[model samples]
Target: MMPSDAPPPLPEDLFAAARQARTNAYAPYSRFKVGAAVRTADGRLFAGANMENAAYPQGQCAEANALGAMVSAVGGQRIIEVAVVGGREDDPQDLCTPCGGCRQRLREFGTETLLIHICGPDGRRHTTTLGVLLPLSFGPDNLDIV
Candidate 1:
């Protein structure tokens, strides 16, 4: 058993998945590759790599791709946690975090307390909750739904 005050150990599988996914990223413009993985409440894991487009604004984020995979596999499932890794293709040791849009995208399927594990080439470097990244945010619960 682990102590209540102690932080949970890093999910090694998620880190490996995310790191592997980063190699598949299509980044012709910025040369910045990113990978992201998400674990659903049901324990399902999904990973994805960033894909850049000719038009800068049209690029797809790694987190969005991972979420899409989860939604396709199991619709409407809640995301319990996420891991994101990113860095320049040449040097993948720098730390990275989800963008504002990606954060909102994650919010669609996760709660404010959802944990996001930030990682670098070494491994999981930091951990933070969605609420900390996006404070006082609105979500599906904020509006009417069938």
Candidate 2:
């Protein structure tokens, strides 16, 4: 068991899980595998890999998958941080950030201050916030729903 006051897992630790998740990606079309991990406020981590489909746009991104797992296991939990890792073995420009749609999807669960890390499978890392990734974005509050 971890101490209550123990520091949350480091970015690299989350990236490592994302890297492992990437191996399970089902990307036969684009061949671009992506993995994502989400850390909840309580330090719980959930990881997911991209699943592609032959039918266009009938696939789920790694970020969405991770968020789905997080919410399914812990309803009403807010995501505090997110780390995404992806790329191809042949042309490795990993440091994969959430796509536009994924960013919006994440906004549904994470606050504007949520930390986001884009990382390569080899451990390259970059950090930013959801607000930075999607500035002045429309969200639940925009509709007076939050």
Candidate 3:
């Protein structure tokens, strides 16, 4: 059972969508599978899983994959919410927050959007606004392209 204050339990379909993506993860090195589901402002949901490579630096984060999918599927629509989950056996509690690069990407789309982090079977969730996650983040405003 999930905690009483766990963001009112995301729609079952939403979770299933993320889980399906998790199954496709290609993590032979770390064996740490991660899945991300991103909801766009247009009501489109894009899901992606981590893809690891032998060259550690070449691997893509789950969040980045999801974000890329969202952009590709919806022509760069603004993102609304992002949920990240991970574990050995589809456990959600073991999920960790997005890395610095992912955070910056979130800021580019929606700095004030909600980030939902699910831990495990109990559905333990941590919610935080993207602005809180990336303070003073650089974005379009920072780039001076004349």
Candidate 4:
């Protein structure tokens, strides 16, 4: 999670970054290109795209890849704002929200107020907070510390 529970407003370019990353998705099997971008507590932005593998579950979601990029950049910065863009290459769908597993993954580094922006390839978008999306959920604090 972030060093502080309360985070500031989102950056202006987060969605652009996510959409740009979406162009680089590696989804040969599903053709569903998804991209994710997260802003760290310090204001640095990182982006990642979905990658599919022949081994099915071995693939990684764009959210996971974005989180990995955040960690790789400076090691687990709290994700203050998140933007996700996804749609089939041939057709731009209406919804592109994170999957169930990816939602939990986002919880690993986000607090209740973390803002999530869901976007369609057609440029339509929706905004919601993590608290609203994953209410009454489990997280790191649920685990007993040593």
Best by TM-score: 1
Give lDDT tens digits, candidate 1, residues 18-96: 8888889999999888999999887889999999999888999999999988888788778988889886434445558
Q: What is the lDDT of residue 56 in candidate 1?
A: 89
Deviation in angstroms for 102 in model 3?
A: 0.8
Q: What number of clashing residue pairs does each candidate have, in the order they appear?
A: 0, 0, 4, 0
lDDT of 3 by residue, 1-146 (tens): 22345454565555666677777889999988778888877777889899998989999988889889877776666777777767645544454678888888777777454555554423435666676777777776567531
Candidate 4 ranges with C-alpha deviation above 4 Å: 1-11, 88-93, 143-146
lDDT for model 3, please. Answer: 0.71
Shift of residue 79 alpha carbon in model 2, Å: 0.7
Model 4, residue 20: C-alpha shift (Å):
1.1
The lDDT for every candidate, in the order shown, is 0.84, 0.81, 0.71, 0.82
Q: In candidate 2, which residue ranges exceed 4 Å CA deviation?
A: 1-10, 88-94, 143-146
Q: List the residue pairs that clash in candidate 4.
A: none
The order by descending lDDT is: 1, 4, 2, 3
lDDT of 4 by residue, 9-41 (tens): 444589788888999999999888899999888
Candidate 4 clashes: the total is: 0
Question: TM-score per candidate, in order?
Answer: 0.88, 0.84, 0.80, 0.84
Q: Is candidate 1 or candidate 4 better by lDDT?
A: 1
- Residue pairs with colliding backbones in model 1 are none
Off by over 4 Å in 1: 1-6, 88-93, 144-146
